[model samples]
Target: MTRAILEPVDADIDPRVLRDIYGQFPSGVAAVCALVDGSPVGMAVSSFTSVSVQPPLVSVCIANTSTTWPVLRAGRRLGVSVLGEAHEEACRRLAARTDDRFRGLDLHVSGNGAVLVDGAPAWLDCSVEAEYPAGDHTVVLLRIAGFRIDPRARPLIFHRSGFRQLVER
Candidate 1:
């Protein structure tokens, strides 16, 4: 048996190199949305993760330059939709820097203004609990008020800078 030695790169790595390295890890896509002034405002994020179960907290990283975040953060409640395998187009649409992000997408707006994708595998009604400034991004902590899960739906996976599907062994 043999093992190859690996070298550590400099701390100030190029952003493209960093992205390429980070893309090696697969992640689930989430659509964070809310109803603002009778319209759906949303963005697709691959950095969504569950933080604390006891306190019912989740976190999503938003780029500091994101214009949508400022608008969405002002909402009373936000909906985090764990997108399904069938939502590739919807995810692309939401991620685009366009005005009509919700166009042609099926959605449900809760009484509290959380706008969720209709067939998402999971949905969480959350409010912004806290936000921390990170380099070029903001880590938003959300307090989960309510949630629902559809066991049968398969989640949309992001890997190697593209959308992917799960394969069972």
Candidate 2:
């Protein structure tokens, strides 16, 4: 077995280089959304992850400067939809800085007011469990209330700052 050597990092790290380095790891994209003030508020996140199974916890990182996170956190429940491979356009639309983020997409709203995107591979209905500061972004911990998965769909992958589809070998 070969062991890799480790090196110490410098204090000054270029944000662009850091982003590029992080982008090397492919991750699934998810639409984090909620109904706020009688409307749907959402944002696309590549940082969604499952944290715990005992309490059904999941998390998504939101930028500290995000205007949408404020509105989303005010809602009782938040929705997380794992985008499908065919949802590249929808993901772009959801991430755009526009008034109507949910403008031309099929949606499903839960009784607690989580707005879920249609055709997503999976959906998670959650409530904010906790939040912690993490550099320029806020790590939001969500406690899952309910969830569903579609067997026929595949997740949308974000790699090197672009959308990618997985090929079955």
Best-fitting candidate, scored by lDDT:
1
Q: Where does model 1 exceed 4 Å of error?
A: 1-4
Report the Cα lDDT for residue 35, model 2: 89
Name every residue pair that clashes in candidate 1.
Answer: none
Worst 10 residues of 2 by lDDT: 6-15
- lDDT by residue (1-169, candidate 1, tens digit) is 8998976789787889889989999999999999888888999999999999999999999999999999999888999999999999999999999988888999998889999998999999999999999999999999999999999999999999999999999
Q: How many clashes in each structure?
A: 0, 0
Instruction: Summarize candidate 2's per-residue lDDT along 1-169 as a digit string, tens digits.
Output: 9998965568787888889989999999999998888988999999999999999999999999998888889988999999999899989988999987788899999999999999999999999999999999999999999998998999999999999999999
TM-score of each predicted structure versus truth: 0.95, 0.95
The candidate 1 region of ten consecutive residues with least summed lDDT is 6-15
lDDT of 2 at 155: 98
